[model samples]
Target: MDLIDRYIYAVTRRLPTEQRSDIEKELRGLIEDMLAASADLATKSASGPASDQTNATIRVLKDLGHPALLAARYRGSSQHLIGPEIYFLYTMVMKIVLLATGGGLLIAMIVSLITGAGGNPFTIILETLGSLISGLAAAFGWVTLVFAAIERFSPEKIKLDRDDIFDPLDLPEIPAKKDRIHPSDPIASMIFMLIAMVVASFVPRFVGIFWLDDPASNFIPLFNSAVFMMYLPFILATMAITLTREIGKLVSGRWTLGLALLSLGVEIPSLILTIVMMSNKDLFNDAIFTQIFAWLHQSDPFYFDLPMKILVGRIVIGLGVFGFVVEAVKTFVFWIKRAD
Candidate 1:
């Protein structure tokens, strides 16, 4: 019964929400009928009904094949630019690119506002919007073009080769249920890293504050743009490594020592960069702070000078370090335990 329930869940989960209830009900009824028929046949032969029913259920599920394949069959074929073989990969790539582009543009816009790139807040916002739209369009077009080319010329490249791919005996052992990673975890991490990289590399200026009264001229940039740009290559390299590791996890569906090591590879460099950036005294725009304090001092004569900019930078850097260490240690421990 548990197996049957799990099978039903697996099949229906891939379906649209509106169709799931009906499909689940139908599957349950069909399975029950099959089991009943098998039970009756076994009873006629003086065999146990419960054992026969279990065997019948297993046979029925095996004949039905993978749940994903069954779900696809139920959905029926529809025209698509890419075939099912490569469709999931195509969508994943598109999602990453779009998110990165949008995130980069948003960061750029914020930086522009703080740096007064166009000398006016309105102009900065307009430029940011324009960049975001254009960047998304370009990314979409490029990804579609690449996938379309693959679909057109080399469809077989993405196909699972039955003849020469691997030895059946050498296939990976099935992971323990407890150790198996959920498919969504790596996907979410990939998206998050892509966005973070875009923000760090492309929009460092946006990490600032603005005075509501004079939005155009009273913006304060947190980090020194020139200094941050110097570390762009390292940031990008770390992002690339993280992306590759995440994609591997997506394909493999579990964590391993290799992945844990790669994760540390990403974290170490990132941690170093965070320390370097935070240590630079020039990283905080002191002029902006001075200007803000000067404006506020007029309204509140007793207003004391507070090093909010430095305090905020330290807090952010500290949090980043903490998160990176926790993840790295956790991954390393999991891998070690698995090895043991």
Candidate 2:
């Protein structure tokens, strides 16, 4: 019974979350039918002790074959950018490359801060953030390109991951409830974080106020460039921490006490830094607001004064604090339940 549950979990976990529930039901029905048929066949042929039922169950499972292979069947195709034969190798190589890239960029950033690189601190931080983003992206891209090429071009004779020969007995042990992780979760999070980091690092100037009737050249940036650059280092720090957490999940394929603690450790400081950055009125482009008022053909009003700015900052800080609390609570709950 546990085996059947494990097999179903394995097969459905590989699928999209929206499809998992339907597929799980389908798998259960199929397994039940197979077992019933096997029972009837065994009854007609011969009689035996309880061991016969156990043997029948094993036979049905073996006939169903490996969970990965079954999942592929349900997916309707076996093709992939990187085929099964080298997928494990691809992931391993990717982890190594990403780690190396992150570590190198981090060292460079620290050195720049210490030695007072040619530029001011704000400019130096922006540069480091850009370099970090580009370096990690390049590493990810090159490794993936090479691996996909290998998967496509390699000789037919080359195979791995039990591709040439597979055995149901080789099925992995069923992980504990807390230990099971859907690969897609961490992967999707990483993609989102990467996009956010890129926008923050390279495209802050493009984030601006624009008039629908005017040309793009008339755009006024939302934040003073110099002031924005000063906050880039904070963004960089949070991105690094978030990326590290996701990578840990990816590599371990599960949550651990260390990972949970790492999240809380970074989250508190990140929230503080975010609040400090958001509360700074100097970051807002005074010229941009003046231009906005001029374009509206209205004089500056008391409603758009210091108190208004303080109100907006308070709203942002409130939302940020709520988010931080939710994330912290989730981490603590998961860790506590798993520990129990």
Candidate 3:
């Protein structure tokens, strides 16, 4: 293939299939201009009507830059989508959307089945499957259209002005924010943990339900199951907190106090768990102390004895107190300065 055709193919192939033909046409037009320039140059030169097709093409291509570089220019010199990242993000977003929809639908169906709606088993299953498929197809169609439209409308074709010209545009850059959840985060997490602990501890004793005509017998999955189910709330809360922390740093800017408060909402469970852990020793085996005594006794199990655990715990608690005092003093000083 000719140099122009090869260059066009290399670049337009990187674009969406729908856009490739139109892009190829534009690229060919550009090549034609370059070829014309070279031909005119040859005619005007003092070499006496000399013309070499290979030399002329090489000269034209060389002036246009490397094939890849020339192709990249069409994606807008200032802002453009890289070949790989475009497809990757598209797929990633599509996956998240699909998962969200599918999960919601599945949860709903399962809950409905568990609640015992009067319906034929086979018919219900078939209906559910058909509905799911239909919903997924409809969602896929809309989602695919949205992605395709975004790809089509990408501002990759805007001609960039040469650096020699005066420019006035200035973009504001938002700094990445840190997500340091306030004390509130720990509170919510503690609450979730406690709820999980309580439900795990007591809820099973009260759970009695009949699945079939058989006597209502055998409640609570297992002790391990109870523990896991109880902790589900805390696990979910922690994940939410972590997500907010990351997202606060990203799309929303920084981890502001507002986000910290939101994290606290989740941390409530954690605080409750911590408190419960501190007050209750019977809940734990001999090896496991209530959360408080455990923290107080925390030491290298292999390296330290009870004495060292107490010693280290006391020192750590002292340090925590000292830190609080220092912060309080600093705040007082700031207030004094403001008053003066």
Candidate 4:
């Protein structure tokens, strides 16, 4: 291509379409005129008029950053996922997910060693791989889901907003709508969570009444049976919603009801077992909680030993707190979507 043409392209690349043709024409004319003027000015020299149009074009290109940088000037701020913002988010999330996956495997290895899960090294390695794969997949699944959702529903896609650079004459004032519509309002979520927290804080008391007198009622296997009674609210509250929402949202569109059913299904079975064991006096102390409690009773200043007696208050109040939290999240998400 000609020196003038190359110079024109380099300059025009940064300009928007509206001004590109005009700028290209102006640039082309300027380069040609400058070269012609230079030749006349250098009539006395062997260096030959600023070293020819090619040399002048090379000098001009060096002053400009690049075709991409030039294009960016007229384009203004961007909303692309591959841009700086996404890179930042991806870097952060990647760090977290990788840590989570590694931690899961590390925990699995430690537990496997303690439990003597398998007799052979091969089996242990196999178990470790299984645990690692599951953890990584879950981490990536949620991470992918996050980016996908953000891409689909980012606020920039909504055309109702006007650019900040506005002219009063171009924009007429329209009366605002009475309703303020937004996606996932945090205030509503906070209120709902607070209510759920209150509810979960109390449910165990009501539920624990069923377990009151049975001698076998307190022994819990993986966790303290009394923990089931006292903090059932907290455990069920967090787990039910977190598990259900994650699982339900993964499988279906209707998450609120699925989470509700999931909470009931998950929470009720254990509650039933607790009630049955409590009524039958089949409760056993959690070896860990028992040991810890024994140590605390012996070591601590509470001049009294905390009776390992099944706590009616703990069960009722702890679960009440948990249930209240999960329900609150569900209700908040449901209503916000409904409003939208």
Clashes of each: 3, 0, 24, 36
What is each predicted model's overall lDDT from 0 to 1?
Answer: 0.72, 0.71, 0.48, 0.49
Instruction: Judge candidate 2 at residue 142 and give its lDDT.
Output: 66
On the 0 to 100 scale, the lDDT of residue 125 in model 1 is: 81
lDDT at position 319, candidate 2: 91
Q: TM-score of model 3 relative to the true fold?
A: 0.33
Candidate 2, RMSD to the unseen true structure: 21.6
Pairs with steric clashes in candidate 1: 110-206, 111-205, 111-206
Instruction: List TM-score per model, in order.
Output: 0.53, 0.49, 0.33, 0.35
In model 4, the Cα lDDT at residue 130 comes to: 76
Candidate 3, residue 195: the lDDT equals 35
Candidates 1 and 2: which is better by lDDT?
A: 1
Ranked by lDDT, top first: 1, 2, 4, 3
Residue clash pairs of candidate 2: none
Residue 20 local lDDT, model 1 = 100
Q: Tens-digit lDDT track for model 1 on 1-340?
A: 9999999999999998999999999999988887777666667666566776778889878877899989989987543567776689778878877887787677667766656644579877877787677768866876677667666555244434324565679666787786677868877887787677667654455566755564345555666778777877887777766765665566557566666677677678778777777776677777666666776775333444536665656887899889987887788788878778
Regions of model 2 farther than 4 Å from truth: 1-179, 214-216, 291-298, 304-306
RMSD of 1: 17.9
